[model samples]
Target: MSTLDALQAALAEEHATLWTYGVLGARTSQSASPALYDAVTAAYRRHRARRDQLRLLVRDAGGEPVAAAVAYELDGALVRPPQVQRAAVGLEAAGVETLLALVARSSGEVRDWALTEATWSAVWQLELGGAAQTWPGAPELD
Candidate 1:
């Protein structure tokens, strides 16, 4: 995939992550985890910001941003407490993998550079993601 292609893929991943978070947040009891709720909200905002950046880049290249899916596959059949945490981990892992792939598949100097930067950002994001999802309710709102 080219840089533009990688960007689009990253955009899609963002969309997917956004969707998954929405579902997970909704499934979780807001009252039960105020902190988690706040964190999730913040994560969404950040995702939206990054998404806009990606969209602008795509648009500047005369391409439209990929539309988000109306629904996600629920990331497999994980639904219980531990299952939910495991699911979150799985989603974040997938996002990291895609981002890394984008970096590897990228072409062009500027685009490659952007991909590299995005890859590093994702590495950091995944670390946080790992902690948040490591335990069923570790960073849960308390």
Candidate 2:
């Protein structure tokens, strides 16, 4: 795939992740679930920043960035803190896949940026209670 294509795919995943995080954040209570709320909020902010950066990257590459869907379907119920954490982990895991693709299709600064993003996703997954993986984005290795 072309770098632009990979970037767009990554952008799309970011969009979905941001949407899911937003929902997760809304369901969480600051006083009742401080840790989960903070985690979700942090992930949401990170993804939002990445989404904006991706838009700039796409535009600089002379391609239009893909728009986020009106809403994203949650992986499962997010009523409780554990459920929210699980969902956040799932989203980061999925995002790692796209970031890996971005790294593969890009080079130089873009590839470096993608590598950083993928590493952060893996760490974020662990923060959300996921097991650490030798190859975070490659589920086949897990």
Candidate 3:
């Protein structure tokens, strides 16, 4: 796919991630699990920033930014902290994969930006209780 297409896909993932984080944050209690709540809040802000960045990137690349869906379908139940952590890991993993695709399909500043984003997402996976993988984005290698 083209670089613009890859970027749009990554932006779409960020949009969904932001929404899912909101759900996770609502379920997580600051008093009961302060660390988790803080992590969720930080992640939400980070993804929102990424979404905004992607929109600008798309515009700079001469493409119209893709609009986010009204809501995204989540995988499984996210009632407990463990479940929420797992869901967060999954979201980061997905982001890493999407960013990797963007990295491969782009060059120069866009590729560099995607690599940085992918690195962050990979680290987040481990922080969220995911086992470290040799290739964080490439599940086929793990």
Task: Note the residue pairs that clash in candidate 1.
Answer: 33-141, 35-141, 36-141
lDDT of 3 at 140: 94
Ranking by lDDT: 3, 2, 1
Lowest lDDT block of 10, candidate 2:
68-77
Per residue, candidate 3 scores C-alpha lDDT tens digits across 1-142 of 9998998999888889999999999999999988888888888988998999999999998999999899999888999999998899899999999999999999999999899989998998877778999998997975
Please report how far candidate 3 places residue 25 from its true position, in Å. 0.7
What is each predicted model's overall lDDT from 0 to 1?
0.63, 0.89, 0.91
Q: For residues 19-57, could you state the per-residue lDDT of candidate 2 as single tens digits?
A: 888899999999999988888999999999999989888
TM-score of 1: 0.68
Give the residue spans of candidate 3 off by over 4 A. none
Worst 10 residues of 3 by lDDT: 121-130
Candidate 3 shows a clash count of 0
